[model samples]
Target chain A: MSENKTVLYSYWRSSCSWRVRVALAYKKIKYEYKAIHLLKDGGQQKTEEYSKINPMKAIPTLEIDGHIIGQSLAILEYLEETHPENPLMPNGAYERAIARQMMQIIGSDIQPLQNLKILGLVGQYSGDEAKKAEWARTIITNGFNGLEKLLEKHSGKFCVGDSVSFADLCLPAQVYNANRFNVDMTPYPNITRVNQYLLTIPEFIEALPQNQPDAEPQC
Target chain B: MSENKTVLYSYWRSSCSWRVRVALAYKKIKYEYKAIHLLKDGGQQKTEEYSKINPMKAIPTLEIDGHIIGQSLAILEYLEETHPENPLMPNGAYERAIARQMMQIIGSDIQPLQNLKILGLVGQYSGDEAKKAEWARTIITNGFNGLEKLLEKHSGKFCVGDSVSFADLCLPAQVYNANRFNVDMTPYPNITRVNQYLLTIPEFIEALPQNQPDAEPQC
Candidate 1:
């Protein structure tokens, strides 16, 4: 696939978007990054034009090989299958299942609870900023607590084994969000260690929200 | 895998667990069903012994061949990989991604927002029964709206094509939940059509929450 043909609709700080960005970078697949700022202009993702691309109105929609794909996990699976050279999953079926288990723990179980829209609803329902923060922290901490236990058995250098898989792609983004909510990471040494190691990799570093082209200056 | 060796820790009403049951039945995999009541006895899933099996304390934890697996999606993928005869995914990579995209739409986006635990949080935050119901309705309606559009192009007797896939496993359970929360389904004709069609399948019908051995008598 040519570099120019792949376009990713993304936002710098969206964890789901970050997962796709890191996966693309890791696979060495060249793609155009079209930043759809999640917060600007009442959330660009919710606009009519963007909804045509992804009906879910979520960021990190990948337009690749003339097919538009939504959902970061779906995008990662597509990349892993189509671009098989640098595989993002383990070889064994059981091992691959374990890796996917880790991904779902973060993607389905953790991230969705603390997503921007969900947090907004929490704020709306609670009418307290501290309560919203607390809600985020509680979910993140619970997720991490489970993750830490899983990683104790699965971690080698990354989230599965010695190789970097999709689980590794998910780690940094989630840990980034965990820190944003001021969740204590001290209890999860394995996650912290894997996250630290992942950040050092060039692809991961390049995919960091701060390094993205459309990143706004942090407050 | 021997039926005696395979055990699934599940709850009759848990949508995530329901997804696994449909997948297992569809794949013709024999497994022992061990009910872990989520609401009874202060949530049996939170007990110390259950936690040892699944640290996350979530339902539909599958134990087969001495390996324990959590996450409905992961379990489905594992079943697909291990029991490839009755494949739950399409052949082409792109089509597979679309199937997964559909699954994630229900699994990550819709289900998580309306999950029992999240709804409990919403209730706590709102401190009003009406507001809690509204919160559930809003998220489910938003998700169904997106799903309706996607299904317009993707549905063919199922969420992906004219065959059962992981997406099909997710659809029935979600639509079931949508009904429980009283979300207006009139606007989503595609979902309603597909869901009505899915209910006719024997595997799906057998996997209904009310059909499970541990099903409680509804009030």
Candidate 2:
């Protein structure tokens, strides 16, 4: 597995994909970006070839040294383990658990409900964009507000105790995605502040959807 | 923080709450159970009193030695750390990653979409149990299938390489919840077998929702 090249099966606009992309860059791991256009070809994630790579047919499957890892949090941890020099978690066990808690809020609690695929399903099943949007807004607000309160206790320029842990790598893309759906963040002052600070960094700025190699707007 | 008693604020039927309950029992960590019924009186989780304890207004909030932890997966890791005697993760870095990866599939992937609160919302907005059931089945099947494949590579009597890690602690409750919703598990042979095996063990058996002190037949 060590001799093989690194490749990422990803979509430029996928928030989960973006999280993995930023983590790879943060750890300075060089890899090939194989863009799987999610919208085109009736969601390329469902294709046989792609499904072979990931049975779940989800974007952002990381192929490192031929060992494939799916799930963004798992991929991020794999990168951290294989490249421990740039740790995405804190030093102590308690601190690391706290960071994982923050990452969980965005990864499990918030992102899944607001994902493009789920939203598309809502469109098909209910034909109630207004209702779906309200659902999205309520959960996003609940998640962010919980995150905001938790951040109040531990955040110091970053989601954890100042250093850029996995939490920082996850939050911005999600907040960005939420705004696109008109889920306002002005009520979430801490999220807005942390996101603003993250945007100023070159790694995060470069990892934004508009700045990706296959980005649409070419930011 | 280590001196205070461990208190768990949980709902009887919540899969998220069950994840933490199983983890604590696995580690033999003593705790107080404070049940907050999610369905009673327009959801007890929405109360300002409970919200103060957890801004997410979610159940399974663990107050360990005065430190409050909300997310179930995070709380489980905290248990593993504080009581490392019965270690939940394997020793090797790669093995540990695989264990966490499995937990993420259940904790982050399957459990979130089919959570009781989300189903309540689906009932409220869509007013159709059949449609809500379909959505639950779709995501849970996708999650379990991904897990079954990963287990193909990672399993050895347990979710990881032989030991009952956090991943094992997470699975039974998930499969049970899926069964409650009538999602057939005959397709995933490995998962069904492992879940059946875990059921015989006393720790897991004690943590089963039907066996819990507060578990109502309706919950």
Candidate 3:
């Protein structure tokens, strides 16, 4: 029973956390969610208990039979491997590379610059909300421009060669993050199309930050 | 004969380029190196010819059998898949996840913040070399700290439960990058020890940036 059980420590609004949630749901793996608010008391992830589970003290830590795993991309690969039934990666080596490349574009190229801590730095140093927004927008637009060009050549029904690879799991959350800063998604038809398609998927739909149990309802 | 050839478009000093170089050598694959000087004349990677090969215009774009691949982690995985004779990843899915996580730490979490362009941003917007260095130090410290804790638990002969995964390829370049800014490696025993062991491996030793044909001769 312990071996079959999986648990994820996640924040309700974290894009990284959302990526894992989408992956788990896509794989149809049942797991327990332990919410750690990133804002309350200066982030509950800083707690001693959480540190023991993940020294980075970040969210979307997966526990499989008590073995802890951190990092959203790592967690997705783990889920894909553990549950190979509904394969996220394609059959060929090149295809897999294309899939992972798209994932990296968002995971590495875009997300880090706009992360909470980095944005905090922008706020403190720049002291201009518009400047911070522009800073965030610059990286997102740069990354997405590259992604759009690449997707222009390779995208089919999804990122990569048509199948719903792990890259698909990443698109919505990343698009959502960009939207938070008012990044004009209108420029990239490929990205907008993929995001719209991803929204229709049951797994991706349920993993939306707004759909979380801890979501703050809008007035 | 063309299909049998593997060519890597790389800059000798680029950390991302080094990742693919080490992987190619580790797999014992013979390939051609096309040097694209990243810093000369406003960057050779920005050229139209290179952009045709890689939309991202990044270092370490790999061409194998007429097919192209980009992104360090993606290329490494591609090499692992196409040439399974020399396995870099561990046997189990969970262990493989651990390896990917370490790569993500280096690739996603750490590298971007320290890139030439980001440092330029710091200098441009934040207004000082000192501030840029401080920003670089902060993220490097944060990433290394997170990785050190992770390595404490997971490392054996190498990061991610041993046997030279992609994590081994990632660590050296990052450690080297930090040292370029004078970040002390002595602070990390695990990282230091692993890097020492990796240096002993002929493949890694052979792929050092200083050894490449395009490496500038320093007086």
Off by over 4 Å in 2: A1-4, A129-131
Off by over 4 Å in 3: A1-3, A127-129
iRMS, all models: 0.9, 1.8, 1.2
Native-referenced Cα lDDT, model 1:
0.89
Tell me the tens digit of each residue's lDDT in model 1 across A42-65.
999999999988999997899998
**What ranking of all candidate models by lDDT puts the best one first?**
1, 3, 2
Q: What proportion of true contacts does candidate 2 retain?
A: 0.62
Q: Put down candidate 3 lDDT per residue, B1-219, tens digits, no spaces.
A: 266678888888888989888899878988998999988979999999888888777878888866788888889888888889878888978778888888888898899888987888777777666788777888888889889887888899799776889889998888888887778776688988888889889889888999898999853
My TM-score estimates for the predictions, one after another, are 0.97, 0.94, 0.96
Q: How accurate is candidate 2 locally (lDDT)?
A: 0.81
**Which model is ahead, 1 or 3, in terms of DockQ?**
1
DockQ of 3: 0.74
| Candidate 2 positional error at A58, Å | 0.4
What stretches of model 1 exceed 4 Å from their correct place? A1-4, B1-4
Residue A214 local lDDT, model 3: 83
How should the candidates be ordered by DockQ, best one leading? 1, 3, 2
lDDT of 3 by residue, A1-219 (tens): 266678888887898999888878877888888889998989898898888877777887998855678899998888777788878788887888888888888898888888887888776666565678888898899899889988888888888776888788889878887888899988799989878888988988889888887888753
| Clashing residue pairs found in predicted model 3 | none
Model 2 residue pairs with clashes = none
